[model samples]
Target chain A: MAEQAFVTGKIETPVGTVPQVATGVSWRDRWGAFRVRLGFGRMRYTVEPGLYGVGAPRQDSPVLVTANYKLSFDHLRTALAGHDAWILVLDTSGINVWCAAGKGTFGTAPLSVQVAASRLAQLVGHRRLVVPQLGAPGIAAHAVKRQCGFSVVFGPVQARHLPEFLGRGMQATPAMRRKTFSLSERAVLVPVELVIACKWALPLAVVLSGISGLFGPAAFWENVREHGGWTMAGLGSGIVAGTVLTPLLLPVLPGRAFSLKGAVAGLMAGLAFLAVLLSRPGGAGNDFAVWAWLLLIPAIASFFGMEFTGASTYTSLSGVRKEMRIAVPLQVAATLCGMLLLFCARRLP
Target chain B: MRRRQLYLRGVATLRLEQDGCMGCGMCLAVCPQEVFVMAHGKARISEQDACMECGACMMNCPAGVIWVQSGVGCAQAVFHAMLGRGSEACCAIEEKPGGGSCC
Candidate 1:
């Protein structure tokens, strides 16, 4: 396969345009779907840690660094198109460079060893290494310099803008340094999350609806069916709210913490639920129904909204911690209250 | 505009040396920061400030030329580290906002 061919070669790193699995290979295996065979036919495309070529030049080219993840190698190699360069791959257990660097896999020791193993000093003409910006946290520049006899220069965050950055002579502007969660960026995450959730949510919804049908009044059974549909809709809305709307409304969201923003979105979702209740127009329904409606909907929405913060450019661990401390308990209590309300409503009329 | 340092005040930084760069431009292409640039047959650090320390560039460089420490930006990982659960890996759990565990 073309994907595997790229994986095997050292001189040319494939660009991002290539799919994970090339044409001709069974598409099902490449996607890692259709588990019916259970490892009967598995596909792999991860790059092994070692030396590589970047750009178009031969052995004497500049050496770039990255993890053994094929995609990461592909992106870096593909970006260099016309130039010849050396690539040093680290062992990050198939994780991407950013995360591996954070965890110290891309740090000093491996770099020093890879440099020695690759005999990089003998292969290249310079002693300066260009490093990515995101990896800065894990690397101790002074330590690396002492060990490798090379200084470290921190570069921009994105790869596409490299040509212009190079044209401008190694200077980064404020905009270049700032990370933006663009629409396309946000949209990419939806499929992965949706794929994961679709597996469990569907079966759970069916079970919950079946349980609701066995107890309570006709209204409760009706509510259960409606609840299943609403729950599914809520999940989809959560994706839209977090992935689509959050990025667009990021500046205007109510709180400093993403959870708070989600909570606000949840409040809006709660109002929608209220509208549903109002449409029924039943006098003297138990407060349980109202309480449940208020609590459950918002909690669901809030949960999804908060999850988006993990993927966004903004948001801090401590901020998330504080928000969780307050929000989780509140959500749990609200859900319990809603269930209680459902019980109280069942006892009435 | 009230801008307070919410949580990431003590974050980290990764630096590369241009003198050691072979102009592979590998870091230049993979970084989310647009930090590295190619110049005069070598890769240079065009921008140093935009890095979040994710370290993707360092891991993917084939020449073993990149070096950096990186971690996920999600709150769960940091929270775990703060709670002394530093070894656990936490990813984004789409529906459970603020809900992460030690494992």
Candidate 2:
């Protein structure tokens, strides 16, 4: 097979000619990362699972393990810039280390198998492998040692901290071990959320707009132009409120439940939409329509917000289940009531 | 910076059978939330509420003392589970031919 573009050269090892990878991420790599962030070709962005050399590693070099997901591999390689290391890329089906580990694809079995497949025992002098800390969820350190004769030493949570952690003799500080959901980290997730939301929102908007045009007083096209436009705007606002605003202002948003926080953001977006509507010529004349939107926006936003709990860092399975039990019913009821009010408004005026 | 806390305090299902712990300290080394600490050669829960139920400690523990209803804390996954889809359905990418989907 042809070598990947990121492969700069080859290192002659006892097992075979191991591909030597670039330590610096190229513009192409950056663009690929950006594309995946937008949810395009994300699952397909994987490198071949094998052993790769970085910075002319020798038999005594540390063997760092990571997933075959190109992004994860890139992060690890880039962090090891000036250091000589052997990267044992495990087959993780294109998922990142953390998520892959959660799925058990990055567990003890894969680690042991990869170690044997790469002939790492012969390639490295030491009987140790530095696994990413997040992979601990799947990796049984004792089991890996027993199965492969190599003890597992988990590295820091983020690959960027590798240099410092390695400099400190592979000891991660408390801060390095802990994962934080900072603003920038949350912000990067917004694009994919928005894209996924739009996939359903656009179609739902069309359906709702069509239904609105069927009942309003004016001619079909005329009503479609007025009511339908407002319907699209309302749905758009709800999507933005849930997927964008809720995540951006997560910490400050009131209520502990993600659904509640999303509702607040949705209500704010609804009010902003109302403000824009009222400022227009012959402001939305129907009070029922106004009430409909007031209910619908928050409901829509809340549902989306609740979905975000999947993406959030701190939420626990038990806590999310508890929140969902109450939140789902409320969201459904509010949506039904909002639709009823909207129908009433359209029928009258 | 202060860590942001999640809702419903003391809600995590994470439990430790103290008698079974061998004090290997794997839980302390692997936990991302600092939920575990070594005390008297055995692992103890230092911050139970902080546990995100990632199952790192449980998976890494040699003594099999830790237990939690481990799964993604995602509402989407819950909804999928409610609809008869598997709990791992959250954030599933479109699968290519001969490939599997993932979060």
Candidate 2 C-alpha lDDT tens digits along A79-131: 99999999999988788888778878888999999999999999888999999
| lDDT of every predicted structure (CA atoms) | 0.56, 0.87
Model 2, B47: alpha-carbon shift in Å? 2.3
lDDT of 2 at A53: 93
**After aligning candidate 2 to the native by TM-score, how far in Å is the CA of A153 from where it should be?**
0.3
The parts of candidate 1 lying over 4 Å away from their true place are A1-3, A7-45, A196-204, A218-227, A230-244, A273-287, B1-73, B78-103
> Model 2 over residues B1-103: C-alpha lDDT tens digits?
7655656577898999999999888898898888888889888998888888889999988889999988778887776778876445353433553222225
Q: What TM-score does each of the candidates earn?
A: 0.68, 0.95
| lDDT tens readout by residue for model 1, A71-134 | 5565666666555556678876555555566567767788777777767676666786666565
- Backbone clashes under 3 angstroms, per model: 80, 0
Lowest summed lDDT window (length 10), candidate 2 chain A: A1-10
Q: Can you tell me the DockQ of model 1? A: 0.15
